[model samples]
Target: MSANQLNYSVSNAGAFSDFASVTEGMLKGKIFLKDGLQLTSMEVSLNHLPPKGEVPFYHKHQQNEELYIFLQGQGRIQVDGNEVDVHEGTSIRIAPDGVRALRNTSATQGLHFIVIQAKENSLTQWVETDGIILDQPVEWITRSSCLK
Candidate 1:
């Protein structure tokens, strides 16, 4: 019988830990690549607004499917001209060419969730948000909640 070859290391504690200071303001992601692990699963632990909090641009996928699993916190989901409220323990699936965006309405509390890009050669698309002017850079979540 032949044997397979595989080796890896513990990445930033190997598993999930208390994301207090690590995930402060914008969205922070820790890649497990340098840790020497295969890309078995596509996962991201999102804390805070993840760079562009309230004003997330609306865009579509070129060739990938995405899903946002709300581990904790609350937010609203806008898809294909429809808006859906998302909360903890909720998994929202988005398809290609589908319009999508999320906004955090909490005051002090932040939204914690895992982004699962279930498609290969596909990346998160936020090129043209719904109401965003597309020329000006979004400062921060100036609005209380999502418009659409």
Candidate 2:
């Protein structure tokens, strides 16, 4: 396939939403053109949670690393069993083996965040977040079968 066939983009405002209920709470999610774009080794989405909503499970990836950038309201992210506060402007990076989950703690506003997942050991650079970069490679062993 041509490279042009592999490249596609969508605006958040134009994306369609999907809903899921998990142990944490109700999730209103908008996937970033996964089917249409035919992405490989990467995934992106926007998640919005009402007050007191949360992701039900602590999940880990064996081949993919994840990054979450908080966009609105407030929430708590549990990473490796530790709960950390997150709000607008907060960014988090989770390696493939790190167990992670999220909860929306905001009472009046929704908790909105952008999630990006890429293959483990991939080079990632952020213009913001102090120009953060990740370049180290890791050989991750799966804890169990992935349910993703």
TM-score: model 2 vs. ground truth: 0.66
Clash pairs for candidate 2? 24-54, 24-56
Name the candidate that leads on lDDT.
2
Which residue ranges in model 1 land beyond 4 Å of their true spot?
1-9, 13-37, 40-47, 50-52, 120-148
TM-scores of the candidates are 0.55, 0.66
Per residue, candidate 1 scores C-alpha lDDT tens digits across 4-65 of 24553333323222443453334343222311433464534334443224534787787667
lDDT of each: 0.57, 0.71
Q: Which candidate number has the best TM-score?
A: 2
Model 2 ranges with Cα > 4 A deviation? 1-7, 11-27, 30-32, 124-148
For candidate 1, list the clashing residue pairs, or say none. Answer: 27-50, 27-51, 57-129, 58-129
Relative to the unseen true structure, what is the Cα RMSD of model 1?
Answer: 19.1
